[model samples]
Target: MGRDRANIRVDLWADGDWRGLSMGAQHLYQQILTHPTLNYAGVADWRPGRLAALTKDRTAADVQRDACELTEAHFIHADDTTEEVLVRSFARHDGVIRHPRLHVTMANDFAGIASTDIKEFFAFEIQKLNQEQPELALWNHPKVQTILKAKARDMKEVTQRVRQEEAMTFGSATAKPMAKDPNSVSMRTATATATSSKEDIPSSEISDEIPRPDVDELLDLLDSCLLANGTRKPSRNKKNREAARLLLDRDGYKVEQVAWMIRWATADEFWRANILSMSKLREKFDQLKAKAGVATKTPSAGFHGEIDVEAVLGRDVWTPGTPPEGLDVAGEIAWKKEQRNIHNAERLAEAKQKLGIS
Candidate 1:
């Protein structure tokens, strides 16, 4: 019969294993044990999603996690396919097993259990109860024998299935295989560098007195790229902020160039950990561009307007570096720098004029 009332031990709080359970799991355990419809057999419906809907500020995932924790702790056994739970100690603790008169009631409740896994667990507990209290003498009872025989078949099927799985996969002993989805966010952590050779760093001096909004956007992009590359989030304090501002505003580095460097450095096996800060990024921009195989290469020739590698590596391995025949590599760099200086001058002049600065 579904119990109208449930008994709880006060010493339960003092139990180290019980206290070790997460508060959510502990709450769920109590909820299940005290449920008004909890049957004599300790088996009950375990619908995490439906239970979550009736609770405050808890999702189905939270309930599912709690259920798993309880199951792992051996406080309960849950069968996902059957959506049912068997509280391991319910019958013994509730005095049902000790009272031989209650066996009929327990058998009636057992008939309603749909989970073979739960039935197996329940039968094992009954055998233990019989040994602990031989006076009850339930070991050879018709009901106990029937439950044991059913679980025996269940165990045989489980053993056969495990054997078949072992014949199939290398990880048959493991619970599950690791994820292999290519497009998933998970990625191998490439090497990361926290320090760079200071001698190789360029002087990053900011000329503009005001903050550049575009530079801040570039810093945000760098942070996002770092996370995407499976690296820890890089810091974005004012020191790095000013460095990026100088890189774009005074050093003539284009926003697109900085964006490309940010992505390449974060994804590169060697550079991912090293160029973690904007100061490092700005100081070693030329080195990064060269390592990226684009120091003297034209910017607008490759996939999505990046460096054209075909030009770097000639049309054929035997041919000389193509570089877009007669493309003045040095002249191009100088011209771009000169244009950026002119643009910056115009922008500075406009700002000064607006601010009435002589």
Candidate 2:
């Protein structure tokens, strides 16, 4: 008798667009009458029968409308209404700043059709909203706010647990000292050799013979090594070794300085075992020096070195140009003699022309 239950529709709109006009009236009535308030707050302890009853007559329109209204109410009380805190929260959870469509699809399991263009579209939309309507921060949305609050509480508990575990593990490890094996002669020999090598190296040789690696060359080598390793663990150790070699070669840095520059945990240990390996240091230094010499000989390198604004402008300031002081007077004199010979040849040609010689 109630208009023959077959025909009914629920009108719903989201983001200012009509979602759909076709929905069963009975479904709409059931959703309104049986919707649980506790469930909205994420208390999912509802009995199975009650949940089934609530979904019995539900339509896509009903779900969309409810979602929109719930979101709007949450954001209504926020200082920033347009903020997409939900998207931000999702990104943080996933540990990515931005992803292409394929990534997003994989992450969300194709929540909808995902294409590269669609990903770009969403990214652009988010950027525009954040920039133009920052007041709509995602924290304003009820669903996002609820999720964020729960996440915060969970994170705090997790952090506390982790700290407690770490402390206990550290205490146990420290309580038992590593027992020294009475029969370990190899380690003793190695330590003895390292110490002897350090003592045998003369101070004057260490100070006067070593040369520092050029910063650019060191950087390139580090980059190559890091790329090959594909991990940060070896990178630090490699950097320390390279720095020690450079300082040892330059004769300018002490072992402590080398350790400090490379951030070694134990400067004494590094000096004892590593810096004393001066033969390897010399090899690396020679290779780097040869490469630098070749680069310096190239025309491009010459041009780059000669184009200094200060040098060109200050050429007449009477600064010494020699290795220890001013330019070589002998070299200057030889260059002038060559110029004079050229001038004499030109004069002889002019004299021949005046005499009408062929």
Candidate number with greatest lDDT: 1
**Tens-digit per-residue lDDT, 3-25, candidate 2:** 11111123323422223322332
Candidate 1 residues 1-358, lDDT tens each? 4678878888899989899888888888888888765788898766665566667986544565576566545687665435467788886788886566777678667766766667776777766666577776554567755654555222233333433432243233321211111111011101111122122123344434566779878988988876675444545644466667767766777787778778776665445545656866775676677555554323344323544333333222221222334433233334544664665355544544554544
RMSD of each: 25.1, 30.6
Q: Give candidate 1 regions above 4 Å deviation.
A: 137-141, 148-358
lDDT of 1: 0.58
Could you tell me the C-alpha RMSD of candidate 2 in Å?
Answer: 30.6
Q: Model 2: how far is 154 from its true place, Å?
A: 66
Model 1 clash count equals 3
> Candidate 2: global Cα-lDDT?
0.28
CA-lDDT, candidates in order? 0.58, 0.28
